[model samples]
Target: MDSITQLHATTPEKLTEAILDGVRKEINDLKKEFQPKEPDEFLTRKDTAELLKISLVCLHDWCNKGIIKPYKLGNRTYFSRKELVDNVFNSNL
Candidate 1:
């Protein structure tokens, strides 16, 4: 029931560029909508990866070693945006 599922077989090679461009545009729009008045102060694994410019493996290792603690929600995990920003700004990494 994916809306864009039809794009796979019907789309031309050039359609990939167009599709990607549209997707990027939508993501940028969403980002603007989520811009916090202050700060998010929390983020997901993918968000942490983007902020740290590191792979999930490295983050996982740090979590295991207790270098940084994660906020667990049931089986899910996440990092604090404040913690990451503070660490980066303080040159902890």
Candidate 2:
């Protein structure tokens, strides 16, 4: 059983508070379940270059040198923003 299910309160105020708290928690859980998660975003070469504050040539050089991984689909190449953030920030730690 959930914590809310096991709740036992003597005073009316305490009982009311517990019920309200349980309802609130159930609403929050439903909201979390129904809410659509963000899709994985892929940045274009130009977008990635601008994000990194580097020139397009430099970005390509990094990709070629295997410094940063690239995702290629047909004629297009892309980079993951999440991976970039993790790589840049996690390296400092």
Candidate 3:
């Protein structure tokens, strides 16, 4: 006969600590993923704006019009550096 410890009763302090620890771990994992393990060209909207010397609004508009497509994930949009470079350098701009 074995007695089981019931973890269904969670103290507020313990719950908070557990939540914070989980969040911290998630943040650390996100940081690692964002650190770029290789030479990649994924750029955020801000990066695209700076690279193209264009406004965020303009970029969003262009993306919407399909002039320059954007990759969306959840709520974030990404642009490829190669595409921007090709557009800027290869074009008559």
Candidate 4:
């Protein structure tokens, strides 16, 4: 069952303000409930190579030649899946 309530406003401006306030509350609630996805997915060197269908040697070479970018943490390297897909789509070949 649903219950309806009436909103009373003295002036048009007050009515507009009340409506805007309700909208703002709804927007705030949505914002609170929203869960944002990760901006980019990180991949390991081997995973990245496998995804690109390239061998480890070739992947390393591409990284060395600046064809593919790599991020290093400690002794490990990572690549952005989004960046790799973008490159594949944008490449001439």
Task: State which candidate has the highest lDDT.
Answer: 4
User: What TM-score, over all chains together, does every model reach?
Assistant: 0.51, 0.65, 0.53, 0.57
Off by over 4 Å in 4: 1-37
The whole-model lDDT of each prediction reads: 0.80, 0.86, 0.86, 0.88
- Regarding TM-score, does 3 or 4 come out ahead? 4
The superposed Cα distance between candidate 4 and the true structure at residue 54, in angstroms, equals: 0.5
RMSD of each: 16.0, 5.8, 13.8, 8.9
lDDT of 3 by residue, 1-93 (tens): 999875778987898999999999999999988886656588999998998899999988888777787989999999888777777558774
lDDT of 1 by residue, 43-88 (tens): 7888888778889999898799886779999888888887766665
Q: Model 2 over residues 1-93: C-alpha lDDT tens digits?
A: 655545454778888888999999999999999999777789999999998899999998988887788999999999988888877546752
| Ranking of all candidate structures by their lDDT, best first | 4, 2, 3, 1
lDDT of 1 at 11: 50
Location of the lowest summed lDDT over 10 successive residues in candidate 2: 1-10
Ranking by TM-score: 2, 4, 3, 1
The better-scoring model by lDDT among 2 and 4 is 4
lDDT of 3 at 8: 75
The residue-by-residue lDDT of candidate 4 on 1-93, one tens digit each, is 999977564777888898999999999999888968669989999899888899999999999888889999999999998888888657974
- Which residue pairs in model 4 clash with each other? none
